[model samples]
Target: MATDSIGNVELTDSTPTDATAFLIEPPRKRTKTTSGRRSRTNFEMLAWLFMRLSGIVLVFLVLGHLIIQLVLDGGVSKISFAFVAGRWASPFWQAWDLLMLWLAMLHGANGMRTVINDYAERPGTRFWLKVLLVAATVFTVLLGTLVIFTFDPNIS
Candidate 1:
């Protein structure tokens, strides 16, 4: 029994004395469940790995892009339509842009999905939020990819 400062509140420490309570349980270790036992896939693990790898790749891609577009040569003033056309004309630049677009979009969308899953209390809310996130990501990726591949320097 104990008394608090607020008032004379009685307290009882009723700790469990069963064998189970006294037994030292080992920390939980995750084992890969057989497909027959569980249908859960390794999606979370893969998503975590993707986040790390994409972050590293994005550092290089985004830094290079910023340096080229905003810092090198005459800086932002030199980034004219013709400048963009010239850069996109090269296959290497095109591929770089495409990879950057895909990785950035996917990484951002995955991050949003994780946020939604963690914060959204309702299952329906989570599902719809993820759907919207995925739809927007897919749309943006497709549009960016189309523009990158189908860009015409001759457009007046």
Candidate 2:
């Protein structure tokens, strides 16, 4: 084990596998205090954490939604235009669906963004892909919100 000037054992060369050579070089001492480039912020960390939290919340929201829409009362038979109108008339159900839509889309989109960032090696490609992802996410969320708020059952 080679110790730096600070006496910390370096693990850089400890791995002898041929594949390890292709990996990013171990950070050098200068990198620890480099000032030119901005360090990674907490956004990615928060995004990962959010994915986990949202996934858990989505489980409950989805299950409750499934139960109410597909398993309660008379199952799918109870779900008619009037049933939907009545449900949407209540602010509670509207809020529930809205939350579900927003959370699910954001969670799934962020997950895909992470995947793209990891796999897309080119900066330009990643930029355009993320732009498309953001546009789609925004469009879907906005369209769903509009439909939820503007649904008019009384219209003949």
Candidate 3:
């Protein structure tokens, strides 16, 4: 058994034959992290489902937003603060923007988390990356929601 520089874990070349290489087999059943015990929660499955559902919803939301904001406006020059204020004055439009804001932020954050998990080999690096991701996601969501709901139109 060879150990890494950390001198804690005993690395071995042997791995379970059941865990065939990627693409050759479906994903192996997930177990408890590092403990070899079975995990009770299906967090990963829920996240995967969220990604798929949100992606579909986002496609429609983004397309509709684009059509209304850009193409129907006859280009970017037509968009103005007055136009946005008028749109947001309606509760329905406010809700629509809020939903889009939340879904897009969460969808992007989850994808980034997956990327960090896959690429960040070091535990410390992965942890910090996710912490930053969560912080940024929360900050953006809060800021965006605040801007949408508390928009003050009187500012000259």
Per TM-score, the best of the predicted structures is 3
Per-model CA lDDT versus the true structure: 0.90, 0.90, 0.89
Worst 10 residues of 1 by lDDT: 10-19
Q: State the weakest 10-residue window (summed lDDT) of model 3.
A: 9-18
lDDT of residue 33 for candidate 2? 52
Question: Candidate 1: where is the Cα deviation over 4 Å?
Answer: 1-38
| All candidates: TM-score | 0.74, 0.71, 0.76
Score candidate 3 by lDDT: 0.89
By TM-score: ranked, best first: 3, 1, 2
lDDT of 3 by residue, 1-156 (tens): 556798766645445556845586565655466577667899889999999999999999999998898888577778999988889989998998999999999999999999999999778999999999999999999999999989987768
CA RMSD (A), model 2: 10.9
Better of 1 and 3 by lDDT: 1
Look at candidate 2 and give me any clashing residue pairs. none
Q: How close is candidate 1 to the true structure, as a TM-score?
A: 0.74
Superposed model 3: Cα runs more than 4 Å off: 1-35
